[model samples]
Target: MGKLVFLSGAGLSAPSGLSTFRDNDGLWEQYDLDIVCNYQTWIKNFNLVHEFYNKRRLELRKVTPNKMHEKIAEISKRFEVINFTQNVDDLLERAGCENVIHLHGKLLELHCTNCNDITKLNLNDDLEFKFENCKKCQSKLIKPSVVFFGEQAPFYTDLYSTFYNLNEDDLVVIIGTSGAVININYLLRFAKSKNILINLEKNKYINEALFSHIIYKSCDECIDELEQIIQEWNS
Candidate 1:
């Protein structure tokens, strides 16, 4: 059976009241990437970085999945689907979408540098507001399970493997990403399948020519159309 591969970014989660990084009033404007998101400065500015992601984790807990997320979850039940997301948020998983491949990583998880063990953060409890010692290794060197600006993304190999194996009969749908970090133009070169892009506006970083279809609209606004396409393809 042909698979539907959803390559999503911050725009996919924008409707859930999350801030995107590339927009005019995005999070990048509020926080300095050099201090909070750079790997080189992370160790020195550990407190600042931990505080930054802690706040985001709390924010993530408060917001619920929007229509697009729910729609993707519903579609997955009847069709072969795989999600490769640049966004670290768990909105997709919370919406019941399975087979999600987080290229950047997850927000509600911590990685211990000492033991390399990943621990799921408990948002139900009062957040400590500090990077607590890893339970497995008792080391204070725990960072959010996210790829920093200069850090290598270990999950990219999974994404590459998935893309490398895609056949011409498959479908690639990209949503709400500017392609500044993950090169959408380059990655799609491996997909010899139908490519679709859904976004509110044109992205200069993306090579529009590569896409077979493009929709300039909010993800929620295009859900009905997207669902119809997916349903038809699955049938």
Candidate 2:
């Protein structure tokens, strides 16, 4: 099978109208990253944490999948595509792509922190902020199962193993995410050690040695080029 794995970041969704996790000002707008996203913050201020996520969930409803998303979905038809995205939006799935792995967590699914029971939520403009209670235990429900800062990333071992075991000829695409966080820098190194082709957007601080080709463009533009490259390779 043609192996092509894509690791997408916030940049991939920007064209779709979703705001990046960090704005140009280096904050998620009004909220400090540590005070609202860390484990201590969640334990100290559950209500505030819930409110922050609820706001993000509401925003997710307003965005639509961009051309880049569509192109990725279309490319998957001819290749064994594995999309591991940091984005919580459902755009990739909406674009008809399968085998998507969400590293951060999805915005549409809610989970009871007490019971760990996950359920899909329907979002609308009229959506009210009602704290859902777990049916089994009657405990307060939290937002979807996601890995916040200071929390160990869920399924780290599984993801590592999956990528490590892939054939040497497999292609790995990294988009929009920074060189750090979610252990992406480590994964990039691993891919490089094996001489796998790594593609990513040109970021100044990112170690240039890790990537085979650095596309100096946004994710939307990169996807357009990627689609063309894949088509030519297949032909």
Candidate 3:
């Protein structure tokens, strides 16, 4: 009867063949984040940004959920699980997890700049960058739904609310986040609960002191240990 809040990032989906922005040959290397993923210059490089995300959408369709994602989905069936992910991919949904909240928005969706109506992109065919009209308002200012660096995340309010409402006995599990975009320490300040951190590498940005338990391993590598810890906590 306990709540488990999973604060997952790109690492959660990395095992499924998706690349993180920080990866050596990752998207960030191929394209400058300031030019491609920054909201301030989004309009200036509209076609470039669209092309980048369009390729990502196509790549997402080719990969399947890994063991870690499937395990998390299985755990959700037995516990009160809430997912807050910074990733734009739908791998968690594809792995059968329900009601996963995307903190950074999603890739397979386009929002009208003028009307702000979100439309699901068709991945059945090859995606290309084009100024598509909005389905609802018929405005021609559509862009990828993912939140850029300079834009405000619409779901941050929900994230703060979720943390503030938590009980001290609840568990907060942070996975694969480097605290680059979202400050881990600041977010955890609202949660009066035990915390866990799982990451593949050490990040200077993250304060290791915050977590009661820390695992420096990939999500897939530590799934068994992670499940055991969660089970013990629930018990």
Tens digits of per-residue lDDT, candidate 3, 58-87, equal 887788888888988998888898999999
The candidate with the higher lDDT, 1 or 3, is 3
lDDT of 1: 0.83
TM-score of 2: 0.85
Q: lDDT of all predictions, in order shown?
A: 0.83, 0.69, 0.85
**Top lDDT prediction, candidate number:** 3
Which segments of candidate 2 are over 4 A away from where they belong? 24-27, 124-129, 141-143, 183-185, 192-201, 232-235
Candidate 2's residue-wise lDDT over 71-118, tens digit each?
879878878877788888889988888878888777777678787877
TM-scores of all predicted structures: 0.92, 0.85, 0.92
Error of 2 at 168 (Å): 2.4
Error of 3 at 86 (Å): 0.3
Global Cα RMSD, each model? 1.9, 3.0, 1.8
TM-score of 3: 0.92
Candidate 1 error regions (>4 Å): 24-30
How many backbone overlaps does candidate 2 show? 0
Models sorted by TM-score, best on top: 3, 1, 2
